[model samples]
Target: MQAFIGASLLSSSAAQPKRKPFEIYDRRLQGFTLRVQSTGVRSYYARFGRNRRVVLGKVGTLAPEEARERCQKVLGHFAHGRHPLHGIGGTDAITLGMFIADTYTTWVKASRPRTAANTLEKLHRLFRTWYPEPLTAITLERIESWKARRLNAGRSAATVLRDLFTLSSVLRRAVTVGELTENPVRRVDKPRIDRRGKVRFLDQAEESRLRDALKARDEEMQKLRTAANERRQKRHKELLPRLTHFGDHLTPALLLSMNTGLRRGEVLKLRWACVDFDRRLLTVEGRNAKNRQTRHVPLNEEAMSALQRWREQSGSRRRLFDVATGFRTAWEKLLKRATITRFRWHDLRHHFASRLVQHGVPLNTVRDLLGHSSVAMSLRYAHLAPDQRREAVAKLNEKPLLALTMRLQWDGFPAGSHYRIDSMVEREGLEPSTPAL
Candidate 1:
C-alpha cells in the first residue's frame, strides 16, 4: 500500500531515507504523489490512463501542494487526449538542418523555384555553420553577433540584410509548422542601406567607346569565322559550329539591354513566342518577370534592328542568344577593350531609363517600361530630368504673372498721369484726376 505523503514529509529530511525508487500517494490530492529513489532523491508526478505517467518536478523545486496542482492540469490534458509536450517536438529532435532540408526546402521549391534556389545558395553561403545545430540554438544574441561580423567584414548592408531576411523567413516557417517555438529573428533589427548610393550608367562618351570596341571585336570575330569555315572538314565541322562569331550574340545582347531596360535574367530567358516582330512588341511573361506581372515593351528603331539582325545572322530559333554560358568573362573583356571602368551589365538598364527620363519621358511611363512593381522604385530616375525642373521654374517668368503684378501696382491709373483716376481715387480716398477738357 502507498503511504500518504505531504509537504511536511518533503521538508523534513528525517522523514525520508535512502531507498529504492518508490511512489507515495498524496492524501491531499488524488492521483498526485511524491516519488523517492534509493539515494533519497525525490520528485513529484501524476499518473493517469492506466499506463500514463508525467513527472512534475524535483522535490524542493516544486513543493507537494504546487506539484499536486500541476498534476491536476496534467490529468486534465490526458483526459482531453492531448500530450503535455505535443506542440514541442518529440525529444526536441527538430534540428535546423532537418527543418531546412526536409521542410523549408520542399515548401519553397514547390511555391517559388527560382526564389528557393537563390535562397538556398545564400543560406549555404552564410549559415552553413549553423545548419546542423538545433533550431533553438539560433538565439537572438548569436544572430546579432553574426550580423555585426558580416558588417565588419565589409559586406554591404543590403546584402547582409538580404541574408538575414532569408534566414528569418526559414525560421518563421519553422515556427509556423511547430518545428520551432518562435523565430529569434523577430527580436532582431535589420541592417539599413545608404540611400544615396550612386546609380551607375554609361555617359555618351563611354557609350561611344564601348560601341567602337564592340565593332572592333565584331570584325575580329568575322575574320575568325571566315577562316574557320575555309578550313572545315567532316569531323572538324562539329567544332567549327561552336566557333561562331561572338559579335553575333554579344553585340545584339548589349544593344538590346541598353535599348529595352530588360533585366539580365529576363533578357536571357526571352523566347521566340514572346517576341511579336509583326506587332513590334516584346512581352515579358508574368511567370518570368521579377514582379510576376506581364509587361509589354515596345521595340525602338535600334532594339528592333538589333533583334532582326541577330535573328537573321544566328538563326537561333528558340532563345535569342546562342551563348549558353554566363556573361562575366565576355563582359569583363568588353570593358577592358573599351577602356571603360566600374560598370556592370545591369548598368545598361540604368542607361536606358536615364536616357528616357532625360529625353522628357514621364516617370510613370518609365516605371511601366521597367516593369517596376511600384512607382517609388522608378523615382530614382526622376532627378535625371533636370531640364524638366528648369522648365517648370521658367514658367514663373511668363507674362501673365508679370501683367497681374503691373495691374496691382498701377491700380488701373495711367502711368503718364500725375493724378489718380476716379475709381482709384475713390478706393484710395484721393482726389479724382481733372478732366483734360
Candidate 2:
C-alpha cells in the first residue's frame, strides 16, 4: 500500500508524510531500495533499484491518489513476477529494419495520398541511428537527443518532428497491439512553417494581365492553325489526319486547367462522361480525387464551350485530349510561349480560386467546391475573401448609380425622394436625393 500526502501552494517536502525520500523497504529476493530523488525536477521520485535508480513522476504532477495508484500498479507488476521499474522482458526485441517495414506495409494498405510512403522514406534514411535496440528501450530522452542532434546538423525541426511522428505513431500502434508498453513520440511539437508557406496568387490586375496575354496568344494560335491547315492542304494527305500546330495544342490545355480549376492529376484523368454538357457540370468522382472523394464543378459558358470544342476535335464523349500522356510537356511549351517561367501546374488551381474570389465567391463555398477537410485548410484562400466582398460592391452596377444621379439632377427626385414616395420627409427621415429601391 502507498501513503498519501496533502498538497499546498507552499507545498514542500516538509509538509508531507515520509519515511525517507523514496524510502524502499526490501521484502523481496536479491534486494530493493526505494528512495525519492529529483528526476531533473522538483517533484519527488520514488526510486526502487539497487544500481539503477528508476524515476517515477513529479511529486505534484500526480496527486496523492494517483501516486498511490501508480505505486500499486508497479507493485502488481512485481507481484506477477515482473520487474517493477523497467521490464519483465515480454516484448519481442524486433529489429528496426523489421519494424519499419511492417509500419510501411500497414500504412500503404490503410493510409495513403503518398504521405505514408514519404514518411517511411525518412525513417529508412534515419534507420542506422536508432535500430536494433528493443523498441521499448527507446526512451523520450533518446528521441529528444536524436532530434536535437538532427537540428544541430542543419536539418529542419519540422522535418525531424514529422519523421519522429511517423516512427513514433507506428510504435504506439505496436503498443496498442500488445507489442510494446509505451509511446515515445507523444507530445512532440512540430516545427512552425515560415509565413505558413505563403504565395501571392494572381490579384485582379495580375489576372487581367494574364487574361490579356492569353487573348493575344489565342489570336496568334488562330493564325498559326490557319497556316498549318493551309500547309496540310497543300501537302494533300501526306500524313495522319493533320495534327494541330503546337501553339493550338498548348494554349487550350493551359486555358482549360486555369479555367476549370481541376488538379493536374484530375485533369489528366478527366473522361468524356465526366462532363455533362446539358447541365454545364463536370462530375469528378472521389476515386480520382486526391482525398478519394468525388467533386463536381459547374462549368461557366466559356469552360463548357472549350469542352464542346475539344469533344468535337477529339471525336467523342470520352477524354477531351488525345495526346493524354503528360500535360507537363505541353505546359512547359505553353509557359515558354506565355513568358511565365516560374509557375507550376498547381498554380492553375490557385489561379482558379483567386479568380472566383475576385468575382465574389465565398471562401466557404470555394472550400466545399474544392473538398477541403477543414476551414483551417481553406484559410489559405482567406486573402481571397476580402476580394469577394470587394467584388460584391463592384457588382452593384455603379453605372446605374450614375444613371440614378443623372435622373435626380434633371427631374428633381422623380416626384419623391424616399422609397415610400408618399411618406412625409420628417416622418420617414427622408431627403431629396435618389431613393434606395
Candidate 3:
C-alpha cells in the first residue's frame, strides 16, 4: 500500500501484514509490486493493462531486485502489445510437462491424432530430461546442443528434425496461449537433411516376385488354417478358436495399399463407409487424411475386385481389415518370406504413382489422388512420365531434313542437283553464296 525506494525494506515490510491483503508498489520499478497476504506471506507480481497482473515468484525464491528485473521484462512485453505472462505463464510455476499435458497434446489430439501420438512418443523418449523444467528455462543454445548430441548419438537427421519440429510446435502453441514469449526452437537451425529425389517403386520383376510371394503366403496360410481347424475339431476337441485371423489381414492390407496409394495410417484407419462400390471411389475424409484434406481416389479393376471380395468376407464388419491391432510384425514376416528387401509399406504408394506416371497420368491428377497439399510434392514422379522428355526434345526440329549433299563443294552443286538447290533456295528466299570454282 506504500512506495519503497530500495529492496532492503521488502523483508521488514512483508513481516507485518494488515487485516486484509494489500500490495506495496516499488518506487524504483513501475508496475512492480509485492503482495502481502493476511497470513503474512508475500509474493512479487507485475500489474499491467487495467486489472491484469501476473505473478513473478514468492519472496523467498526471488529477491526484491530480481522481482523488479522480471517485472521490467513484463512491462517490456506489455509495451510490444504482448501479454506480460508470455514466457512465465500465469503463475511462473508451470513446467514443460504440465504445459504439454494440459494444453499442447489436447489440441494436437483433436486436430491430428496421428501426429499427436507420434510426437508424444518421441518427446517422452527424447526429451524427458526437460519435463520438470520450467517452460522459460529452455533456451536456443540448449536446443542446438540437444540437436548436436542427437546427431552424434547416431540418430538420423530426418528423425531428429522431426522431433525438433514437434518440440517447436509445442513451444509455438505456448506462445499463442501466452505461455512463452518466443519459441527457442525457431532460433536454432534445423538439421540439414539430404533427401535425394529417389522414387522407390516396384519394377516389373519386383512386382511379379511380390505377387507370387503374396499368393504363396496366402496358400500357405490356408493350409495351416485348415490343418488347425481339423485338429481342433477331431483330435484335441479344444474350447479355443483357430489362430487364422492374423494371416488373413496381411494379404488384403498389402493389396489395398499397393492398388490405392494409401498411406499406412490411412489404410489402417479405412472404414466401410469411405468405400463406395457403386462409384468405384475410395474417399479419404479430411479427419483421416494426412493434410487434413479430403480426397476421392478412383479404384481400378484390381482395387475394385479386391474390395468386393473383402466386403463379402468382412460381412458387416465396421472396418475393412482387422489391422487396427497393427501390421508391423506381419509386414516384416511377409517381406522376409517373399524375399523382398529394403521396401517399406510406404513404397507401395510410390509403386502406384510410378505406374500412373509411366502410363501417362498427369502430375496434378496424381497429386489429387495422393492428397498432396501441393504439386511440388507430386513433381518427384514427373521423371517417370513416359516419353515426356523425349517429346520435348523432339520438338527441336518440326520438319527434319533427310537429304544428303554428297560430292558437293564450296562451288554450286552439280548439274542435276543445281535445280533442287536453286528451287529450294528460291522458295526459302535465301542467297546462294557458293564460291565459284
What Cα-based lDDT does every candidate model obtain? 0.78, 0.60, 0.78
State in Å the error of residue 325, model 3: 2.0
Worst 10 residues of 2 by lDDT: 25-34
Error of 2 at 126 (Å): 4.9
lDDT of 3 by residue, 1-437 (tens): 55772456664645458899887887767788888899978888888877867788887787777778788888897787554544543435767887787567778898676667887888788888999888888899899999999899999999899888889888898888777789999888988875537889887887888888878877787678778778788876763433333247777778888888999889888889999999999998887888888889888888887778666655667877766578888788877877788999999999998888899889988988898888888888988874979888986654322332433333445434542464676788876456465
lDDT of 1 by residue, 64-100 (tens): 6677767877677556544432333252545677567
Give the backbone clash total of model 3. Answer: 1
Per-residue C-alpha lDDT of model 2 across residues 1-437, encoded as one tens digit per residue = 23334344216544344543444332331222234443423343334333433344555465644544555544554455333532322344354554554443464547665456666676667755666676666777777777788788998766776678777766776666455667767755545555335655665565566666766766776676677777877889443332332234445566677777778777767888888888889887787788788888888776776667656555674565556566677556555655665778888887877667667677777776776666566667666557555788897754455555456555446643434333454576756655456
Q: Which stretches of candidate 3 lie over 4 Å from their true place?
A: 1-94, 194-196, 231-247, 393-437
| Residue 33 CA displacement from its true place in model 3, Å | 21
- Backbone clashes, each candidate: 1, 9, 1
- Candidate 1 colliding pairs, count: 1
Q: TM-score for every candidate vs. truth? A: 0.69, 0.56, 0.68
Identify the runs in model 1 with alpha carbons over 4 angstroms from their true place: 1-92, 233-246, 391-437
| Candidate 1 collision pairs | 19-38
Report how far off residue 21 is in candidate 2 (Å): 60
Candidate 1, residue 202: lDDT: 90
